[model samples]
Target chain A: EAEVAQSPRYKITEKSQAVAFWCDPISGHATLYWYRQILGQGPELLVQFQDESVVDDSQLPKDRFSAERLKGVDSTLKIQPAELGDSAMYLCASSFGRGTEAFFGQGTRLTVV
Target chain B: ELKVEQNPLFLSMQEGKNYTIYCNYSTTSDRLYWYRQDPGKSLESLFVLLSNGAVKQEGRLMASLDTKARLSTLHITAAVHDLSATYFCANWVGSNYKLTFGKGTLLTVNP
Candidate 1:
């Protein structure tokens, strides 16, 4: 079965350093999502992409976070000057379209010291 | 803003027992989803409830949705050690197709 692919299963960075995570959604998927999940909480949407355009980023911390889906196939999420609180599981998911089931990737676990 | 809430944040049940996890959303939505996650792992999609009164089942799990009540449920039958995991229910916010998830219910099935 085709699944969303994420790179660097784990990442550890110093506080204030820059870090990035990558995600490649399943083929033919038109919607992509990046979510941040704390250790004991549910995942929270950080940004959403439809094709190559951003649809909603209301919960994204723009001051230090950025994401892009340049070709509408794969995406990258970056955090500049990462903080301790930024340590979390960054999950990428994709779906065929609205109201469809979104499949999640294995996820990248980030820990900032 | 849309909010999702799950009750019984932690549950400990014996094998062969049955239980249900309830999810309540703050707003109206036609789509609800149930996902499972093991410790130190990513989420696994369980069920997608697309309409009011929609119910789906697989293996030992069953999920139902009530769009009018803004509620969804994940029912586990004949619990087993393999069924132990954190289950989350998410509401699909229509305008942007964003999913708002609940805190999750951590279930531990003891054999």
Candidate 2:
């Protein structure tokens, strides 16, 4: 079955350093999402993209976080000057369309030291 | 803002037993989803409840949704070791299609 693909399964970075994560959604999927899961909490939406355009990013901290889906196929999430609290699992998911079931990727675990 | 709440944050049940996980959301939504996650792993989609009174089942798991009540449930039957995992309930906010998830219930099935 086709699945969302994420790169850098694990990342460890020093506080204040820059780090980036990549995600490639399943083919033909028009909606993509990036979520952050804390150690013992649920995943929270960081950003949502629809065909290369950002639909919502209310929860994203613009001061240090940025995400983009350049070609509407794959996406990249970056953190500049990462903070200690930024340690979490970054998950990428995709769906064929809005309000459809989303399939999640393996996710990238980031640990800020 | 939409908020999702789940009860019984941790559960320990014996094999062959049955139990249910409850999810309540703060706002009205027609779409609810259930997902499972193993330790140190990503999420696996379980069920999608699209309408009020919609119920779906697979294997030993059944999920139901009540859009009016803003509630969803995940029922596990004949629990087994393989069924042990963290389950989450997510609500889809309409306009942006953003999902707001609950804290999750960590279930441990003892054999």
Candidate 3:
């Protein structure tokens, strides 16, 4: 059972600090997604990557957030000057290809104080 | 712009009872997905409904999709305490694979 892997299961930082989350999709998966899940809401797509190229990032807050999948296998999401409202569960998911069933990682929970 | 809506945001039912969770989408999409999440856990893939009249079942859970109606349903049969979780339905956005998810239905099966 190949699963997406995420690092820093839990993170706590002060507001205005920088934070980063990492994700490694299942091998051979070409589509990767980053999402943010609020406490009681559905996950919101932040970015999508296909073979190291960004396909969609319309919902991503580019002013403070950035993501990169340089090798198209693993990805990194960084947030500069994190804000209290930025606290949420950062989820990573991947699929064999676009429009396929996606597998999600355990997620990285970020908390800003 | 795509939107997914789920009904009965909170449901509490007795163990061994049956219930259905409905998902309605604002646009037409050939692919729809169902996922389950326990508290503090990641999403667990439940079913992938592709095309109209597609149905899939596992254990006591079953899911169906109707592309024309822009609707999907997840039915739980003879549910148990362990079946309690938050269920979400998601579909592709526009011509891409970016998913738009429903707010989710929180089910609590009381024994």
Candidate 4:
């Protein structure tokens, strides 16, 4: 089975610093997603991409968070000037198409000190 | 906005028991998914219900969806300690591929 890949399994940084997470989806997948998960809550969607184009970014904090899937394959999520509230597990998922089944990456655990 | 909510945010049960977790959505949807997550880990897909009256089961867990009622249920049969984890139900609403996740049901099975 093809698995979604994510980089920097763990990250620790001071508040107001910059941090970036990378994800490589399963081959042939055309839809990608980014989610933020707090300790005890469900993951919330931060962004969604279809063939390198963003379909939803309503939940993303545009002021500090940015994401791009240039080739509609590998994608990246960056957070500049990270705040304490930004400390959470950032997860990446992808599917062959919208409303299709998706596979999730292990995630990048971010700690903002 | 589509809202997903699960009942009994937390649950504790003994091994060999049975329990069901409810997932309710405020709006209509195309499909529903059940995922399991361990502490500090990524989500593991468990089940996906595609249409009304759809039911799928794996191991001791069974999930059913009712699109008309806008609800889904995950039932555990003879739960085991290994089943202890947080389970979330997410739904696909409208044109977005984004899934709205329920708060999750934390199941703790004591041996």
TM-score of chain B of each: 0.95, 0.95, 0.96, 0.95
Return the TM-score for each candidate structure: 0.96, 0.96, 0.97, 0.98
lDDT for each residue of candidate 2 in A20-111, tens digit (9 for 90 to 100): 99999999999999999998889999999999999999989999999999999999999998999999999999999888889999999999
What is candidate 1's lDDT per residue for B1-111, written digit by digit as tens? 568999989999999999999999987778888999999999998888878999999999999998888888888999999999999998877688787889999999998
Rate residue A21 of model 2 by lDDT. Answer: 99
Q: Cα lDDT for residue A65, model 1?
A: 98
Q: Please, what are the lDDT tens digits per residue for candidate 4 over residues A1-113?
A: 79999999999999999999999999999999999999999999999999899999998999999999999999999999899999999999999999899899999999999
Candidate 1 local lDDT, A41-84, one digit each (tens): 99999999999999999989999999999999999999998999
In candidate 3, the second chain superimposes onto the true chain B with a TM-score of: 0.96
Poorly placed runs, candidate 4 (over 4 Å): none
DockQ of each: 0.91, 0.92, 0.91, 0.90
Backbone N/Cα/C clashes per model: 0, 0, 0, 0
CAPRI quality of model 4: high
Writing each residue's lDDT as its tens digit, candidate 2 over B3-71 gives 899988999999999999999998778889999999989999999888899999999999999888888
TM-score of chain B of 4: 0.95
First chain of candidate 4, TM-score? 0.99
CA deviation > 4 Å runs, candidate 3: none
Using lDDT as the measure, the top candidate is: 3
Which of candidates 1 and 4 is the stronger one according to DockQ?
A: 1
lDDT of 4 by residue, B1-111 (tens): 568999989999999999999999986775899999999999999998989999998999999999999889999999999999999999876677567799999999999
Which portions of model 2 miss their true places by more than 4 Å?
none
Model 4 lDDT on a 0 to 1 scale: 0.94
